[model samples]
Target: MSEFIQEKRQYPRKSLEKTAEVLDNDTGLSLGILEDVSKGGFSILTDQGMRPSETRNVTLVLPGPQGSPHKVSLTAECIWCQTITERADFAAGFALRSIEDQDEVALNYYIRDYQVAGQKAGELEES
Candidate 1:
């Protein structure tokens, strides 16, 4: 028998697996991948590990429906970091600290768009 872990999140998360840039708000040099995102926070996969409570600026470059590019930036604080077993990669969870209104709109739209697309795909698969 297999057991699955239950999620305990306030908002639904969308898997992105998209490249993202993480910048240290103070030094302006950080890098990672935007693994998943929710309205309140996101998980980043990186080669480096971060300590809990550390903060950084995350910027996601999402492609628009018309192929144009959209960028959303937000301030986030690291909540937890765990190393991937047998790999050099680490996955870190972050809580959004601050986001401008425009950015928030963009982020919400991006997440909802992906969620809808994913649902449609699932429906197609089940059909």
Candidate 2:
């Protein structure tokens, strides 16, 4: 196992209010945006849905201030999930994979914005 050094930066995570889509590769399902996201992955809150076990494609459109948004399409896999009592949602962990260098740059840039605003890189989730 290789060690993934967590990027040294501010953890700016904001609760997601906009609607995002998650397209299922096998069943063609679109899981709505739950809440919170980061360059690492996201937390999906749903009534209760089965997720893919294998590595699948996950696309997310992140909206920044000033109507400037960056769309990211990358490969990720469902690692684990759990339902918490505090919130009625499934907090899942996803290992980002096959990310384009440009996408990584964009992710960094997004975080940079937060840093510029004296915040950290977080999207209602963890990075």
Give lDDT per model, in order. Answer: 0.74, 0.58
Each candidate's root-mean-square deviation in Å? 4.3, 7.0
Q: Model 1 over residues 48-78: C-alpha lDDT tens digits? A: 8899999877676666666676878889989
Superposition-based RMSD of candidate 2 using all C-alpha atoms, in angstroms:
7.0
Writing each residue's lDDT as its tens digit, candidate 2 over 26-106 gives 555655453655666655665454465657666666666776766766777776667766654566655666789998788
Model 2 misses residue 118 by how many Å? 11
Question: Ten consecutive residues with minimal summed lDDT in candidate 2?
Answer: 115-124
Runs of candidate 1 exceeding 4 Å displacement: 1-6, 17-25, 85-88, 115-127
Which prediction has the highest lDDT against the true structure?
A: 1
Least accurate 10 contiguous residues by lDDT in model 1: 118-127
| Model 2 misplacement above 4 A | 1-29, 51-53, 84-89, 115-127
